[model samples]
Target: MRTTPLLVAAPLAVALALLPVMLVASGAQQVGLWSPWTAAPALATGVALAAVLLPRLDLPRLPWPSALLLLALCAGLGTWAALTHGEHLVVRRDPGAYATYALALARYGGVPLDPGLDVFGLPASDPWVRVGAAANYAVPGTGADGSATLLVSPQFLVGVPALLSGAWLVGGWSGLLVAPAVVAALALAAFAGLAAQLLGARWALLATALLGVSQPVVLVARQTFSEPFSLLYLLTAATLLVLAAASRGQRARLPALVAGLLLGAHLLVRIDAVRELVLLVPLVALLAGRRHPAAGPLAVGTLLTGVPAALATRWWDSPYVASVASSLGPLVAAGAVVTVLSAAALLLGRRVARRWDTTGVPRAAVRAAALLPAVAAATVALVGVGLASRPLWLVDSREPYLPGMEQFVGALQQQQGLPVDGLRTYAEDSVVWLVWWLGPVTVLLALVASVVLAAVGTRAVLSRQPLPRWLLPVVVGLAVTVLSLYRPAITPDHPWADRRYVTVTYPYLVLAATATLAWLVGTGRRGTRPAAAVLAAAMLLPTALATLPLATARTETGQVAAVGAVCAALEDAGPRPAVLAVGFRARVEWAPVVRARCGVPFVGIEEPSAPAGTTLGQVLGDAAATARAGGYAPVVLVGDLTSAQTVADATGVTLPPVVSLRTTEPERLLEERPLETREMTVDAWLAPLP
Candidate 1:
């Protein structure tokens, strides 16, 4: 019994389309149908597109049950993570720059900043949303006082936040964990689908599963980070590239546009993807079976997508410096070198093209296929030479391209100390170190596959019975990917390395691995089961690794028990005016401490700098003004004699004497007094003195 490729393609396509929405839904649902149906425009768009191109529906048939299982797995893994892993209803708004934006949100709207937070208030922390939120807030017009302003742009609300927003809607904001984890899960499933498409069914699932719960992917996605969206973007971009490569004429253009858009959107969120952008161009050209010259125009179009993001990057930290600072001199030079060599190769291909004018497509394609290793090797060697710690010619260009990068490099060097071991030691310990150290096995595997496939896939394309678009890019993209990872930017010896950087490479890496398997097993119906099985196994490892540890009872019993009791009691009590943190340390789960959960805004603090800011003085002034508005000095002033003596002299009312708040520590302070009119009855705050 054999299933047609279209049998898998059409419904898998629908599953790909429904993915984000189902992933976004939290574990709980009151009116589940309306919630998902209302938000999933992507699904509708896919349906509509498929309907419009219904004739193309003639192309492939899908195994409906397998497709259903694949879709379910996304929701399953997501729900598992949401219910079991990561923080819930916790506020950890630390005082960093990200905190500042969270504060600005607090100072202005008080809407929860991240997806994990219930749309109701701050609780869940998501870095993916945080970075974008910062960029959004950076654009100014951040809601004016009172009369309802559209400060947070819904336009930017796609990907993780949009997904998490669904979780927030269903389970409340504290449960936004449900949405992103779901996205992560579905993203893995998509990985499986792509694998099935490019590599065969088993490895497709294998790659998807590996990525879904892989230590770093799960860890970052569980937090308030952008990598989940990055994963999605990479998947979409890689897919489009694959589509464009496999299809001919106008059939490829739409997907190419999609790939370009995803690439552009990716750069906007995390500006570190210029390397991937560089590689996407030629790979797409090679994959499309178009002549190198024809591919040139598409490459330009793809790059043009980044222009909006480049403009934003310039806005972010000053453009003149970002370009150079971002490049890290040697990497830029290497990129330049690759561009020149590749261009020369393309130009030379003209002679080959002319010579083979009647010689036939296969020979021309083999010639083009021949270019893969040269470009790949050039890319790899560039990383090896340029990205190391030793200073080079790039030091001159550092002033413009990357103003802060060299300074960061200097700081890393100074901190690293005399022995080069310091450099190695630091690199090994950082997230960059972890991935690069471990990534080689996978990368090498992918690299070998990419090189072979680039040659093979190119040959096939030239023969005019080409492999799919996605497969070709996977080869070249992986070729470039392995090379890019070797650079110092990801080496941690450089300042640019981070845990999330791998998101840029994930799509191609998986695709290459998938392509390898596809080549090995063949993409015909005969290979589907084994391919699916392989993907399943790869997924379980990471998913278990990511989900199990978090599910285990790790929280201190006292904190958990106390928070649970408090939350239950609070729910029962409903909107009481009780100040949450009374005189401090009220419970083992201290109110202020619990209040400091990640992604929650600083509620009680005031900003001292910039216009319309607030301070302790301003707070008191506002209180005094409130008193004046009521036709008398209504605020009860209370404190120590230093302040009591001063207040006695200034205002007619004498402030009360102060006393030690902690009997153990003389340094600790407190004050109390009675209000004439019960002014702002905040007990922990010094009682107004008479």
Candidate 2:
């Protein structure tokens, strides 16, 4: 097939050009690759130039080198955004758990949860928690005084690690710093590739550009988190699932295998992709229609290959999922209604009926079989909602220091009886629906436009218009995706279930929506560019507005203290006599570092819970074990005296006298040596009984 010259130029220039991420880390390595890659503004300028030039280039078919370069370009720019933008780039806490845990696992040749080996790093309050969840290796230097042992975390998806591997290949620190962006780039490529394939290159480019700047995605990409990267795997799976349905007479085993694997991998990272697996029925329907029997093999392969990580959730965390809230009803209903209505509209369109029939009996039968996949997908949504309603997955919402929020959570815990599964359903559900001004208005408009498009597409289909067979699925998939979003809210605090995790899917969803809409609108010949640009602009402006403050707060000069966190962790890994942690952020960034590098084990004695991932008692338990096992045996435990006193009162666990150390600095790291060792006890429970 002859390729577009613009496609050829886009990848080549992206690979060769400057990227925005280069402006942040010009080969500077923090804990990993993103810290390096040297965010040179020149690189960003070059990328910007390429971004402009490549699209306009009217080149022709390109070779493998060109394709490889294109992939590299996509990978690079994506990595840039991932690092410079995601996870505070400097270090945000959400996915910090993954990095710290991965580093911990990797440190020991990919050991998952070993008791003998001490986890090295700081800044991580519950490195083990993250290590176990991510199910990877290598404990990151948390830029803190302690580290978490990856007792079992290897379940994390390969997205971040794969990208980091690329950066690592580049050099030590440079690769590590570049890794996040690189991985994010790959993710972007997957996202863009699908977008372009389904929505046309123009829409794909516009969606991707917006994605590059969306604050939440940037935050995820900037750090070594996997959500953004994993989303690619998820999208890839969904795309493949669609393909599997259509390629009946062909050998889809390899592609189906890949899709299943991708789906499984995505589950490993987040455990939520299982919801999409419900579409197995639909997939099977397609396979069965051709007597292909590909469904059984496909199912077996996906389950067998993905089982280790998919089941890793239970292996790593306590039991079932546990979290504070279980209110996905709102998000699910909303997402479901949207999805169903959208799909129903598109499928019912007049155009679809005629063209669908023109495919002849064999093709028609194949298309009819698609109903199974759709039904299966719906089943998946139902199952997810069911699992979520019962509540599995451990979740910790910061409350103590947040004043009113503490009562809020307390009331929730009391009302819900503390869902021990720790499965934070709200994080999955409501966060998306939240009325944050973070996304582009185009997302909303896309939904509206998609309805009209569905109408038009249906008309064209019924009238036997020349829309490709491929398009019919794209429209259906888009509708299904939109419907899938309507699962129960994992986060009641946030609405729409459209939070950070799921927004990555928005590119595909929106693209499909727009594609159907545009197809229906007839892709007007003369003003297509202007119309698309206006639509893109409308959809994207809100995200830019939402991200302004975040970007400002993320500059190198501003995050010096965060830098100190890693330095402090490095200091602890050595033989530092005293390992102290300040706030939650301070502890998260520093403790893990100190634990890993200094080999000095310390506990974060701060607020009871919330944001830090666990109670102070939990950190104490791990520290006590680490210190005792390491033979250092903490001579003095440091923290807020008032909070320390509360621990003493709550659990009856005595505190060794605390003497405030306030010499040069204002905040103090109180000292309390352990008189004896024992199991930790806490007053407030985290969740329900497993």
Candidate 3:
């Protein structure tokens, strides 16, 4: 009847064992590492590691019926996610960027990706044609030899791409698309394990089912989003940490070490993980002060993995690191301060306690410390009130971060019939945003639960009572959620921006709510138990209503077919190698696909200025001359009929539209919710140089 720690350890162990190998192989540019022949051994090693680590944890037992129900729930959710996965191949957003990164890694095994642009033989003086630096890609610097090698590196850290690369190698595009679903399922199972440990098995099932069906969870799971992987890693890590805290002696050491490693590995997945890691310094130190056997190993393991991964990210993806440096700087500073303070506390805590016991202290201060639990509970309620009431008084806005973002927001506002305020961020309504998807009942329940739990935790700490194993993870999760809700730091758009909640907030709230419900049912008077059950069932309505419509109707449908058509069109243009010069707009969407999928060198044409015809003409003329001299044909690809004609006039060739495919893209909603997609057309003209 007991579920072994294998359910949690297996996934974490495999991910941990494989991550290093994948990172090393990709960094070394070893294409063979992605092959089945080479990957099988690595997978075997992961299984072996899982087996070795499983025995170290003391996981709780669950009823067989409850376990079966949890399994069935995960299975159904996974199937639904895979069946309705989005086709986000076009490089329009983060999902597209992730897909392209995986494709390149799967094909070439590394980055600073060389698209073989040297064949174009273009002079460095040409300003119109850029060989690298497409959307979501960075041109770090020149090659080692000082030649003008246009090697482009993928933006963001390599963790998600490394995971996706394995999927790409297995099933190509399909595997890559479906990978998030598998991760989501694993994440749900991990959540179940954590919940079981914290709230017991029956409540765990309820919590898992509630979270698994939530809109944000479902939306992210159906595409190649990094949130799913983050969720899986974080939940699994928390589960392992719970098991470690429950155990005694050397048996706790391995799980604690692995838990710290997983927490550190989360940095590789998302740089923002620094926030969570920062909060852990004090928690780990407290455990160390308590003489918990796992504490030393956990701290050591965190540094062992985190320091190196952070440095590697800085080295390989400096541009991304630079972009977030504003926020990252403060977090790192806070982490440093916390670490030093925690160390000081661990070293001198008992001495200080002895001195404090002998020294006279103020009774008022003692009374204040005893009342801290009530203060914490009231603070939670106040925060909830402030967030929920923010929109009534505040209108959050900012100058556009990017050049065209203002205009883009304006257009979206107009489409949704909102007042035209391009600068408006709509961040003030974030609490309402949660209410829209989760419903007010669930939100209220979460708030009440948070208040109750915060009070309990403070009481436990102030009274020197033994803390539950779940206390650290829950506290950390609550802290992170509050911070995220305060400053989402994303473009305020529905569904697209909703991804912020998926990482920690939604799951934390769900767990809090379910745990509270379980408490009410178990501890309340007999007459109130039925009321708790009814309240539990009622919470599902709002979440289900919000999720079902979008879940049934897949967004970005036919995009995979559209991409295939474009690739085929390029192939039909010639048997000889060709340099594809993409027009500015098309380059954002197709440049990566052209280089990686079609296996052609891609050049992006800068936007034309005044005298557009002359500008286009000069750029195409130079491109054709350089391409031919290097023994390759030159072709121009544009996104629209007008751009096609512009290229035709520029090259003085009869350019015809070579590819036009229809598809659906997610609708951009301002204040309104997004439940469906709108039709879109992708057009491309390949003007082969005469």
Best by lDDT: 3
Task: Name the lDDT value of residue 367 in candidate 1.
Answer: 79
The TM-scores of all predictions, comma-separated, are 0.55, 0.55, 0.93
Q: After superposition, how far is residue 75 of candidate 2 from its true place, in Å?
A: 5.8
Ranked by TM-score, the better of candidates 1 and 3 is 3
Ranking by TM-score: 3, 1, 2
Tens-digit lDDT string for candidate 1 (1-690): 344444234433543444323222211111122244555564576456545543442232236555555556556656655554443222221111222222222222222222211221222121111212212221112222332222222112223343444454456434444455655664565555556656555555556555554444544545445566566666655655555566666666555654565565555444445666666545644543344222544565556556655553343443223334545445556667777766676667666777778776675667776676466555544443444332333221113132233454455456545322222323223323333322433444455555565555545544545554555455545544444444424323311233434464655655555555555555567767696456544434433543444333211113223334443433333232121111111211122222222222112212223454433443434444543443332222222334434344443554332222311100100011101111111111122312
Q: How would you encode candidate 2's per-residue C-alpha lDDT over 1-690 as one tens digit per residue?
A: 444443333333543242223222212222233322333344566567556644442233334443444455566557556445322222223344444443432332222333223422233344333321212233333222244433333323433443343344456444554455665665666656555555556556656666665654655565565565555555555445544544544444544654554555454445344445444434343343334534555666567545655343343332223231122223334545554654455445434545656864456655765454445445544543443343254243322322233444445445556643322234332323322433424445545444444545444443323433343344544544544444432323321123343433455445644564456447667777677566656666766676564553322222223334434433443343333342343344434433432334333345534475666456545554555454443322223455445555544564443222111101110111111112211111111000
| C-alpha lDDT values of all predictions | 0.41, 0.42, 0.75
Cand. 2 Cα-lDDT:
0.42
User: Candidate 1: how many backbone clashes?
Assistant: 44
User: Clashes per prediction?
Assistant: 44, 175, 0
Candidate 3 Cα misplacement greater than 4 A, ranges: 1-10, 29-44, 115-117, 131-135, 143-146, 315-317, 344-348, 357-365, 399-407, 417-423, 608-614
